[model samples]
Target: MVARIAAPLRRYLDTEAGSAGLLLLATLAALAWANSPWPDSYDRFWHTELSITLDTHTLNLDLKHWVNDGLMVFFFLVVGLEVKRELAMGELTDRRRAAVPLAAALFGLVAPAVLFLAINPSGEAASAWGVVISTDTAFLLGVLALVGSHVPTGLRLFLLTLAVADDIGALTIIALFYTEDLDLVALALAALGIAAMLFLRYLHVWRGPAYFVLAIGVWIAMYESGVHPTLAGVVIAMFTPAYPARREQVEEAERLTRAFRQSPNPEYARAARLSIERSVSLNERMTRLYHPWTSYVIVPIFALANAGVRLDGDTISDASTSPVTIGIVVGLVLGKLLGIWAGAYAAVRCRLGEFAPGITGLGLAAGAALSGIGFTISLFIVDLALDDPQLADEARIGVLAASVLATVLGWGLFRVAQARQGDMPGRPLKLDPPVDPARDHIRGPLDAPLTLVEYGDFECPFCSTATGSVHELQDRLGDRLRYVFRHLPLDVHPHAPLAAEASEAAAAQGKFWEMYDRLYERQDQLTERDLIVHAYELGLDVERFARELVESRYAPVVRDHVISAEASGVGGTPTFFVNGVRHVGPFDAETLAARLLETAPAA
Candidate 1:
């Protein structure tokens, strides 16, 4: 389940990291084009008008506006999809887990705006405060990857969560503060379009074309209503559903594929494809489809369209004295660092939430420093807030300078952290807490020379499949190996926690291994009532089992294993620790046997 959840996040980060180079290149190209002899051509090309006409009505925009308002919609859509996913099932699902990042993000927004306003308090410059309020997630993650090769997963997750929340605040500010005069009729029409989309979602309409047409309508209506049309992407994405793959849908896909394999028929093939598509939610599917395009193409194009600023000595000399430039630099680089640090500190001190396992104050501080790299959205708001080319250029320079300085600051802090921690490069991957025969559910000899620990979920299909390999290893190794099983039930598996409790309930009656085997054997039938029935079949005290499950007697025990799993960098089910180190790659019987033999004591 962790693999299922983390896979998308990992992909998202990797894509963002990969695209950072392209984004940088585009920014550099834009600056060069603007500063070169062909600077007039740069402006003229972007200002060339393009129009779409339908009978009596027409929609028109210049090249730069099209890129900013149209192409960037997909970028915001990707952002919206990620935020929705996180809110629904990712790190933000747990309130305790979400509290610190949420606080940090909120403070990150407020402090920057306040600092910007303090410097440019009342006039047009103050209106541009939103420029400092967002962090460029791509650049932030990219820099983190570059500077800290072994940064703790918890810190990365914390920063990701903070970025999501910061985006929400930034988008809200754009909508509420930067919008032009309202067009009531067009706004009403846009509202109706959103309503229609919600209705389609309610009716379980999965057809892409239906949503696509409605999204276009909303975008058009928003464009006419004096609201940023890009927001339509966010609205549409918020209504798109996200969920883990369903077991029944997966099983059906397997059946269809098998049928297709048996007889070469297009009907079976189509059915298999449809079944596979239905197994994953539309939100996940669209994110996978569109995120790469946004990260690799649209965002770079945005940078190219917007990052141009003539960096003449006069412009630089003027910007050095410009309050707008000074405000943005101080707000983003200094304000974000201090604000996020304060918020995280307050949250931890107030006991509102604690950082994830393996995350330290230094790591959090490093992440906060990186948050000051507000390149993408800072330049984005520059266009929206400042009409004068000179002021906009100054703001752009401030944004670029803040990003460079923030990167250096973050790199320095991470180095300091590494040195202070005795040059420990990354989070420890060894088996945390170790195996205790008295507490852990162990099989084979307690004093066995070899130890194999598995952090597993009762309802995880992969874990069930891996049970075969475990059985094989046990048979071959006999008394030479002992296996420890720990519960790490995932949120996707609704019944897994209860099932884990059932095993613990059985353990209270000295049948832990029996119940563990039975749970895996009947993975599909792990309902509360089914668990009670399994207790009966196992010849345990069914009444005590049912009572303990009802009372959640073993929840703490299961939670302890989960905490230990996180501390040990276990991200998925069937995670094995051979001896004291995590096992990578295949977990087949042959692999496990070979690894165990390799780790065995000499002679």
Candidate 2:
């Protein structure tokens, strides 16, 4: 269910946002070091030569190049890993859910380039348009956190999905437009390295060392081929497999852990460790291992190296009048804002996609404005696109200025939105269309003192587990608890809507709970024919059930529950509301029972 996915994603966002403070300090330090009395030290220190040598061969670069071309590869690798994971099983897995953001990302890229080019027209500066095509994910999320709890979770998710698509666009531009004078032989060698990586994946080689060596080979080849070596990170990540933890693998891990608990042997411990590791995909494992290092260390180091532009009165004056600087400011600030908003608007209007529930127009515009904080990749592309020192400085200045202005603009818009919507912090989300015995499927006494409502999907594995927990609570609480089930079939579960409709069809025959149990008990067998089989097995009027399902007579009833769930802020399956208030955290039998007792009327 989405709740499982949201846990990891929330952790990722938190880590990235937490690192923003360190990144800010690093940027300020860079500016200070560049403008200090010992200004030349900043340049001299970063430019000091460093190299590795072998017999008749040397790999040489200055310290700055090492940070940019070397350490930053891990940063790109993390980005690539996130993109792959999203495409595999995260937000981007759903076409309808992803369409709006993906379309906005497309325009987010195109509009910035067009605006940059329109201002610079034709010159070396025109090539620097890549500078405005990205949003700094860390800064974007950090600023969003500043907007307080009034910001809906859906809006945060929308922006994160948009950022993923935006990252893909920037990576493609770097690999295609920025490279020059390709050494065909080295490029061919890089191709071979990529092929070898694919072969390893095909061979089911999960060893990190093997892939690490191949990644190094590909990075070196890419460097020699004049294609930005950081791209090798992306290439390696593409071949890295990502999948959810398999149930069988998890069961195997549990078995091994139990054996280890009994025997306490070295072999058992090692086996248990390997079992747990194999249960999770390599891409997720590596992302967890590498993301922190990249966010807190490599990215800030890159910032410190790249953001140290020597700001002086003359430099500021020149940048103020410079067309390149003006273009970058307008491109990132105005272009991203207008482009993202317009693209999202068009997608909804043209019926290509819809925004998440609870995302208002003003919130969308605020998110669009925040997309203009193009700091990290902007500075990165500035290095690749401009050879002139003054030009690069102007670009960096523009990037900094745009980021600050965008943050202010976003904050102001969010303030206006919160005021208009009256969504104050700590507002309790209560169940809408509160449970009614007449209109709901109830399994306990109508006048029970405690009420538990579940907005769940038949096909959700988590909901199936929650079903067991609910049965336990029913056994313990008896007639004191009134349990109600509502339909909220998710789009990812292809069979879930029909399954809900089938349950509704049975409900009309006065056997709703019977059909619910049968469906969850045989989830894999929920095809159209399978639903008919279930209806016949339940001893319902077979022809009548078939006719209702064929006509989709109960679809509106299921849809009404979905609408109510969304209005009540139920984003995922098996969401529980106890005594009319939404429950947070674990949904085990003991947890729910304890919560029910706490909320029960005093004796």
Candidate 3:
């Protein structure tokens, strides 16, 4: 799921923080190696000739080429998959979801590109726009993790979604702007290979090897086709099934659970046990197998192989004075911030889009500043854009400057926002149905997988589903999930009144979730007496509970939650703010899980 491959090529990269750490060390080592007295070794190492061929044809390239052309093909495949899936169901699934990030990414990408181009002009080395606008997730987060406590979960999620959307834009530019001439015969083979991959998926072929084999075919086909072979990874991705599982099918899975409570299929039992022995993997195995590959291998290889540059005795002005380097540095560090901030404000002020909660216009600008961490993809793109030796050199320097500056500035802004958080007053409200008494106020300094602010209605079935889904994520993530619930009673729901009252009564009784359970279990039962009975059943301090409800002790707290929901642009009930992303309906357990992993906290 993490892999952007249109067909889900990232299972290998997901679920492996240890591996990510190793990859980070490797990249740092490469940079250190390149800049050390052994700099010649760095240059020589990548330039080492590597020749490989089929029966009649051969390709001769450096070790770097193999990394980019060979391994990166799979990386691109995952990237391709992510783009396709998002278009189908994620942030870009619909026009509504696509509005904010897409617009932001457009500016994020374009302004920097213009800055790079304007400064560099048409020199032999001036054509590298690819490096100036990228934002590297791994390096960015690695840096952010250093300043752990200060980052609000909301701001982090906002940054993550922006990065995902920015990636799509970056890839598109590469495919459209950077490719070489096409060879018709090879192009035909690649097309035919892609068609076959789609056919296989359509045939319900779940085998990973089959996908891999066909993907290789596509890779080879594209390589010969003379289009940038990497894009073959992107194009074929459009055909991968986004909704790999239908809603009905997912629901069927739930119902089958109870049916199999006392009975286990012998064949399934053996398969399940085997899967667990390896690591309790499940039926939806595509992402599990490939996400890690894309995240770990593809990204790290790209970074290690590309992030090598020498700065011994070099001055900041060495790059700052050069047109290409200056352009890239200023564009990413300055242009990205300007464009993103302006674009977001324009859209929100015009009411074309609204700012997410815990976010002010200024806060959005701060996040945009952070988006300047264009490390991984930036370096990757630089190779494509600055084919000339001189411009490429400039690109390396500029990206380094911009990335560091952006990180520091962005972090500072976020800190300012947090320091002044109490100064910016907001209102939240509670709804019918309460929280579990055993679970309220469950927060700790160590808990940071994500901070979830759920604004839901008890009368809504989806909220009922969300309750279970949140619990499931909590169990899987342990103390990582920090949840704050708010009531946003939709006018359309009829049974909402009693539900709110019950939750309020539960808050009075110090058993919020217990009252919540009763309200949801019997959404159709919402009389005041019904609420009172649930309170007594919870063994509440009956007289004190009644008095608190009368005084509306929980009113202001609940109001803050509701206002926060409104700030996030929730048009309906059952909306949620996960790390600051306003995810609405059509959310399922897997989707939430994938997003959580995608927005996994730094470090």
Candidate 4:
């Protein structure tokens, strides 16, 4: 019963947008509760002591500290797993493909620190410069998702890789600069625990409880050794074996499955299940087990604990002129924008890395701007860097404010990009090589102010649906809006090539629109038999139509349409280009009408 309930919950938690929304709500709830009339209760609750006793050794810390130092260990462990996975087989596995984001992250780290130091060169706040260096992957990716589907896949991958690199830098800074007095004996114990973990791995020990015990010992040792215990989580995860289980194990699972099928008994069923389970590696299994927990529960709990800042007048006034606030705002909002773009640009120019497909300069700039939305890691560093409450509040405010602004800027830039996807100077959606009036099938007047070109496949369901919208547009706009049809029969569709040729054959008989409507009306049936029948129904010379189909006389027209579509960056069927500009917005008649009317001649 518990498994049944958890299955659906786990699926919901895996969705990035849903998880991000929950994180945002948690942050807002924290902010609201912290500023409410009973704000003192907020302080009291988090300060409540939590303690664990094991024999003579006892560990005690406040509830907030436990959430940050204890629960966050799992979060970092997930991050470490992702980094290792990427290094082994994902995008970072390619040095050339990885270099762009890596270089961008490198510059992104140094520029923010340099900017923060420039603002607070010698003061007590100078120690907190690390606060501005990290990018929060969750919040940044969330904001990009909010920008909608127009955000390119390449852009998303670039931002993700850049954030992962930034995290590596943040972890290094915490280990080197944030540590206090070191205890050599505790450090030695921590090393021993790590060594034991490795030795167990070497011995092929895959039991969960054994590893859990070793991880706890390492965390305790690191905590006592004056290094952050969370580092132990990352270190342990890095050691996780990335390779899948052996082929022998997989074959054994297959054999067990066959036995289970043959016997239909409990004994065989259990054996089969165990064999299949063992066939999956521990690294893959752990990632699947913990990712949802870290993303939805642990990260949201961390935000609820850390994002509570009193938003009263005194806090606002203090934050306005505070050097720490100023530095963080400048570093994140401006420094990240300039540094990441410049670094990526330099890498591309110097031939260190080439831009991935569909990544334009404008898109890269927008992604660089969004990288400034640093919330979780920024707040974490604020806690470690400043001891004074006032300065901490100031820095938090700046982080929050800058994050909000960066989200707005990123969204706006991408929206503009979507609207202007294929726009060329002095050309709206003009067909390249100019439409051959002698060969093309066009509806409405030739001299119409607006021309809507559709690169369509008759077999495509979407193109069939869009035909109605096109007809509606023509009836509404009359001679003012002209429509042209071009063939873009993708190879995936078995009958689309012949369908395109049949439409062209109809055009040869000066009955293109009638044949076009017939093809769409009977889209499910488009064989040579179907086309010949449609031609007879349209009163075309059956012999001429059959000859046109066999001879393939108008094949170049179809090929030219495909070439034009490719040059204009048309990626799919039913792609509409209006007045020479590719339309990236909605496909509905009202939106298309509004856009078309913009190109209408002055009265």
TM-scores vs. true structure, each candidate: 0.76, 0.76, 0.67, 0.70
The top-ranked prediction according to lDDT is: 2
Superposition TM-score, candidate 1 onto the true structure: 0.76
Cα lDDT tens digits for candidate 3, 215-251: 8888888887777777876776666555433333434
The lDDT ranking, best first, is: 2, 1, 4, 3
| lDDT of each candidate versus the true structure | 0.87, 0.88, 0.65, 0.81
The backbone clash count of each candidate, in order, is 0, 0, 45, 6
Give model 4's TM-score versus the native structure: 0.70
The list of candidate 4 runs beyond 4 A from truth reads 1-14, 244-249, 264-271, 422-603
lDDT of 4 by residue, 190-218 (tens): 99998998898798676789889999999
Please list the residue runs of candidate 3 whose C-alpha ends up more than 4 Å from where it truly belongs after superposition: 1-24, 143-154, 247-285, 314-317, 422-603
Give a tens-digit lDDT track for model 1, residues 1-603.
Answer: 223225678788888888888899999999999999989988998999999999999999999999999998999899999989888767777788789999999999999899999999987778889999999999998887787545765677789889999998998998899899999999999999999988987886767899889888999999999998888888878888877666557768889999999997888888888888888888889999999999889999999999888888999999999999999999999999999999988898999997665677888788899999999888889989999888888999999999999899988899888788665545467887788777799999999998999999999999998899999999999999999999988888888888988899999999999999999988999997798899898899887777677555566567567767877878788899999889988999999999998988675
- Predicted structure 2: lDDT: 0.88
- Superior by TM-score: candidate 1 or candidate 3: 1
**Candidate 2 least-lDDT 10 residues:** 1-10
Error of 3 at 301 (Å): 2.6
Position 280, candidate 2: lDDT? 84
